[model samples]
Target: MSTTQPQHRSVIDAITAPRDSRVAFSVEFMPPRDDAAEQRMWDAASTFHDLGAAFASVTYGAGGTTRERTGRIARRLSQHPLTTLVHLTLVEHSAAQLESILKDYASLGLTNLLALRGDPPGDPLGEWVPTEGGLNYAIDLIRLTKSIEECRDFTIGVASFPEGHYRAENLEADTHWTLEKLRAGAEFSITQMFFDVEHFLRLRDRLAAADPVHGVKPVIPGLMPITSLRSARRQVELSGSSLPSSLERRLRSAKTDEHVRAVGIEVTSEMAERLIDEGVEDLHFMTMNFARATQEVLHNLGMAPKWQAAA
Candidate 1:
């Protein structure tokens, strides 16, 4: 007997296709640990869908610890209004395990993925180690995903570091690694959270100068609004990103939660404006499972949905 596979559409094409020539927008979510958190995540997903997000992505936890949760959420999100992207990583699983996970995603009609070499579960800054039968680099995972018969039509996205990955030898090496991933079949990339738009511009210019052809792949800038000072600091430490002194000062000076939120919206809105003016085709917000800040930022940019406007 012969079997048939479902026709798959590429997320890269969905995002890049001109939508009245407007800039595209997307959001990222992390897997929740408990039922309450899962409910919150779904609520946030609903908000993003209603806001007309171009696509949404769920992150894989460090060391693949959240594999089941990530898969469950990805499957659920794929059935939602927005196209969902699942994150795959080489951290603690064997090659066969990875293939099985890919098969599960394929069975759910998911065709978008974000490939990565996940961080160490114990300490992200600690020594890197590969699983006994798993791949090492993200390029290897990208190739593996493509090799899977069920995932042949998947549109893969890889991670990029505008400020250079923490473990990279240098900025030049980091850029080269990003290029390698793109050449290995990653259709596009989303950068680590950055406070300075100039960093993203520099990274884009360097990539463009390096290859001039394949380097032109869409490198969407990632932004996380500073809803809380403590969380912002923690994210900076975790991401190895430098917080701009001015923004840090503003966050520190804000004595009230409301004030801090206002500052965050203002700062992120300003950054978004600058990025849009500089020709960035898309903006990916790290929603952190809270949609209000992201929604406000998009509203400030006049990109919010008509329903939001009416509300």
Candidate 2:
């Protein structure tokens, strides 16, 4: 898989588009757990392209287990009509290794990346170990990415947490860190999933106030379609993301997968609609290996056109 070089835009140009603009729609995907699964996932991704997605993502694993595979997929996807954003973590590879990985991506014609401080192995219970010469912060990773003219052309993005980071001293500290990341050359932000809109709006306002110079990137909100009670509860507990009481009640009342999935779809549809109503054009879905629920959410929000409407 190979991609043609992308147009080079300054980081600023890449992030702050005209206000209330509608851009592209995308979804993030993790590598499959096995070869058979990988093939199936690719087939599904291909179908998404045929459905009119603006772009798609391929994720690097927790311990960076699928780094190479992620790159390969990114290259392949970049060749498609859609743009490709490759997720990168700075926790498991040395600076040299990291650079090598980036160079490989560059060679493959990938020009978009999402820099993240990935969950350490056995996350929520295990300690994170930084690889020798690897960055401990996303800002450092952003700076490094910008230093290479060869790779500087990439549209680097950082992760945002609307409800505050998992281990921040406070929301203020999280906001400060986010500023640092932008200053280091992140072109955009993709937020961690949150149930409420206020959290995102508040953070956006706070960040804008703090850094009037660089300006805030278009922090595309992440929308996750909740389909199972067990999964929803687990996600909330693990990420510390709050679930609205009403949503929780609905989930609790759901006795079958269909009931739970329906409730989840309704809640997410409402959220996406409100975001769009607020003038948010770009939405990134955390698909969690299922296509239909995500497809449904986008369709209900009017982002998914007839070609991509849920079947």
Candidate 3:
């Protein structure tokens, strides 16, 4: 799929503008670990850009291990036709160190970011230790990002959990924390990957009811189409999210790897359609450094670039 490049706009604007009726779509990418992987990442980014992604994001590694590579790729992506969102976390860096990193991002002209209180370095489910002088929560990180002089014009986004954050006591507690981040200056949020649309709707409703006066900020649903049952199980385990038994049964019933992929695409496309119909303003796809499955889902939804149909 291909198309002429659209006029540049911040993803914030695309999602927030009342007059713009198109549903915004974005993709998330992780930093590549090697030369070959980097090449693959770039190729996938290029294809997604051509396929009309509103923006692209590069993830920060746990413990900030991929800090340099994340910045490099985010800077490069910013130079392309797509607006790039960089992920920032309070994992292994001190307050001073984080400020310096923000300065580097500013110098690189990166204006979009996703602030997070990342997972513990070696084990995500393990105990989390706050860095000596760093922030302890994502809301604090959001405030720190806004405090940067060079980041005055930056659009900050934060993470949300449709199934509730793993460590939160319950969904109510999770929603409260999510509201705190928005009140702290996060302009929008993208949820952790979830299989159930009802989960997202419930989260959205609770947030809306929480802040009836100012209203809730935009919350984009995040999706990862399952191509393999084993990988899907691992992902859900890591995220502390549940896989619906019905969907799992169907996937397990597939006779071969190719059939599994086909089921995944169909399932994801159906979910996307339902969300879009239910008035979701945006959709954030977790690309996993690969684009074919995602591209297929988009195409199946008739949301693929016009050229894809010709191809």
Candidate 4:
């Protein structure tokens, strides 16, 4: 399929004045590590394009490992109809490198960014050692982006954690930092993945209760549908948290691999249904560079597309 650039708007602008009452769904993508994986990623993109994703994301790799790949892919996605957000992370890169990257993005005609303080490269749970002249916090990165001439007017977003940041002293402190980011000029926030819909509801409520105005700005909850038992376990591990015992037990008891995947999809669909019922402005699916699991979940929610028939 060929790409066609369209007039773009900030995600905030799009969400606040939504075209309809329907709860919209967005998507997240990771940098593919090789040509084969890149083709798989493009195939998934084609599927979502047919399905009409609200918006899409391409982000800095863990510890900025895939920095170049992310920028290259983000530029490509921007040319497509999808309103793609390119993630900017203050991980291990120096200030000069970050500036050059931002300028490159601006020159590429990119208009959106999601600022973050990326986890340590080797181990997400490892000690975070900031680069000598790089920023230490996401808020600082947001401010930096705003101060940059080309990126200053770009729509920016920040990351939120429903369970509280792993390194945060408490949930209150976690909320405090997030509020600070909003004050620093982030237009919206996208949350890290969490299983229980209650946690998402609580976090959303907490933000509204914390700052009745800016905190009420659109918050997009992100999740990855478990495509397999092994993938689910790996996600839980990489999250630096444990799965609820019930989910772990259910997955463990599956008699066959197919059963495990089926259970995962069933559980995800149910949770997504609850979120839609809660009336969220949007649901963000971390597609992991594939579409089947997310496609299945959306289908379960009665949002089916004709990609199979049309393509």
In order, candidate lDDTs are 0.84, 0.74, 0.82, 0.81
lDDT of 4 at 74: 75
**Clashes in model 1: which pairs?**
none
Question: Tens digits of per-residue lDDT for model 3 on 213-280?
Answer: 42377889999988999888999998889999999999999999999989988899899999999898
Best by lDDT: 1
Alpha-carbon shift of residue 245 in model 1 (angstroms): 1.3
- Minimum summed lDDT over a 10-residue window in model 2 is located at 1-10
- Between candidates 2 and 3, which one is better according to lDDT? 3
Best by TM-score: 4
lDDT of 1 by residue, 1-311 (tens): 01222224566766776775357888999888878888888888777766667788888864343666787777666567677788888888888988998898888888898999888768777887999988888999889998999998888899999999998899999999999999989889999999999999999998989988879999999999778888888999888899999889999899898899889888998999999899887899998888888988888888884234324
TM-scores of the candidates are 0.92, 0.87, 0.92, 0.93
Judge candidate 1 at residue 224 and give its lDDT.
92
Per-residue lDDT over 1-311 for candidate 2, one digit per residue giving the tens place of the 0 to 100 score:
22434433333343334432354567778877767777767666765665555567777875444655665666666566546778888766888877887888788777687888777766753566777777887777777788877798888888889999878899999999888888887867888889898897888788889988644567788888888878888888877788889779888898888999899998988888777777664777888766778778766766554334334
In order of listing, the candidates' clash counts read 0, 0, 0, 0
Residue 81 of model 3: what lDDT? 68
Error of 4 at 14 (Å): 3.8
- Residue-level lDDT tens digits of model 4 in 123-236: 888998999998898888888788899888889899998888889899899889899999889988998888877888888898899999878877888878876778877887
